[model samples]
Target: MPLHSLQRLSPTVLLGLWRLSETPADLWPLLPRAEAYRALLPATADGKRQAQWLGGRVLIHRLLAEAAPAVAAAVQVHNDPTGRPWLDGPGAELTVSLSHSGAWVAAILARGGRAGVDIEEIRDKAQRLASKFLAPAEWAAAQAACTTAAEASTHYTLLWSAKETLYKLAAQRGIIFKTQLLLGEFEPRAAGHIPATLVLSDFETRHCICYSQPSPGYVLTYCHESPA
Candidate 1:
């Protein structure tokens, strides 16, 4: 599939999602020449990994072309010490984040602030692994709030994706999701919005995060430093 979806979350922030339908041959011509993007692509030529990597760059290029030309031409997408993808170049001015799951790739582009985006398939692991990321109270609330098993599954994915999204945004060290990232008001749906809070360093400070479900099969969430 070509660019699956695009959203202007704010004047400075752009969100885009792409589902991979193109093979490695079709994507090679579009890949940026920068060596920085090399690691983003896997050694294996055929797989969701390569497709998602190409899809991410495609979305980044599309978003930049639509938003800013200078950023589009000179920008180099690279990873940080924490394995977080970011834009770096003389003309680069956007804070970016990328994620993929189950053949879907997601990207967030923002100016003047941080941005993080995550997409997770609504699989069965969330319910089983809830204890790894959620406190007892949060898990109880989520269970009570979900009306059905499907809803509960999505809720758990949302909870997991929400934290993953926040992790990309904060990009800090030694932050425990179970203890530091507290669950807030979550309105689960096939497609809807969610608000979350993150406590940093043993609850010394808290940051608010934003989330949304862009598609039915995946739970997508994003966060930034902006007030939005």
Candidate 2:
């Protein structure tokens, strides 16, 4: 597939996805001018990291270009002290997050609101680590909902994604994930919003959130201010 022929999803809630049909090396010329310059340093690195970084950059630029062209010019990416990527530019009002696993990349972009996103590669080990991140009630509920190990694993991964999204949002306030972050049980109900809770730091807060199973094998949770 030619890179220019890549699939583009219709825009919704300030989010977009792009599939990179070209190898990392082939993408250099396709990136926006400023991104092409930053990608050059990654090329100097050993091949593995070079490919990883380049692929992420290309996906980010493509999604930003398609979703919010006016703010794309000021879409500067910077790393927090802990190395999480964030935007710091003229369009600082935009809240954006990106996640990728395997070949696909997903990005969430919000204007005048805070947003967070996470994508995990499903695996069995997720069950083993559940105790550390999940509240006791969450653990029991997840176990009861799943009859098979795979089902249980998927449920746990979704819970983890919720906590991760909370983590990123809390980072804005300099809160720690392990201690400050908390999540409630996963109540997958047919009516109304799915029930989940979050606590950022010692303060209990209510967040209006939404999520979707955008594709098979992955879950996406997004927390942001309700549209005004």
Candidate 3:
């Protein structure tokens, strides 16, 4: 029952967040195919990894219950070789993405298109590592846009989270986060929409990413691709 928030982003999209208050034992029974999912856990999996994995599936089912009631209990989560999670069985058509950071896990589902999401616990590490994932100009712009250190911290956290969401949407490997995924310059705030572009060798795609501080010390970002 640690479902922190589930919101209908639009008629076709549903977003949910789960704050971990339960252990693997508590969450095992909440999942649909409990044993199957349990088998997916690696031998090295620790308590936190188990919780994040279980919490993510539980959160997905919670969202599915609202978006596709009849299929909620039947849909299962599977991951590709690249570790991108997808829905199988009755609700196979729903494009979904899942992410976790610290004690928070998030999921986003799109009924007829693709969706991606990420959550991060705000900390100083993001600011220190900004240059690795963000372009030089992007980092400079971020510094110029924010007025205070806290805002700058939040800004960098969001930039990292936004790139993570974009990577999920791409659903492929060999992407260099710093060079390939490009986030447009923006001022930081409580919540807002920002632009991002993914540059491939032969082509590029633009995306609108939504970001917010859903809880204290945490930042969440998600993006969607319209169904064809």
TM-score of each: 0.88, 0.76, 0.93
Candidate lDDT scores, in order, read 0.77, 0.59, 0.88
**Winner by TM-score between candidate 3 and candidate 2:** 3
In model 1, state the lDDT of residue 156: 91
**lDDT at position 7, candidate 2:** 30
- Estimate, for each residue in 1-228, the C-alpha lDDT of model 2 and write its tens digit: 332222332233355554445565776665566553574454356554454455555666665676668767556665556655666665566666766654455566665555666666566666788887766776787888889887877777777777777766555555544444655544653112344445543567666445556556666665655444
Instruction: Write down the RMSD of candidate 3 (Cα, Å).
Output: 1.6
lDDT of 1 by residue, 1-228 (tens): 788888898888889988888886677677566455666665765665676777788788888877787558677777677768777785366778899888789998888777789999988799889989998888888878888788878889888988888778777888888977776765655555555666764455345556666667788888776644
lDDT: worst 10-residue window of model 3: 36-45
Give the per-residue lDDT of model 3 (tens digit) for 125-174.
88899878989888888888878888878888889999999999888789
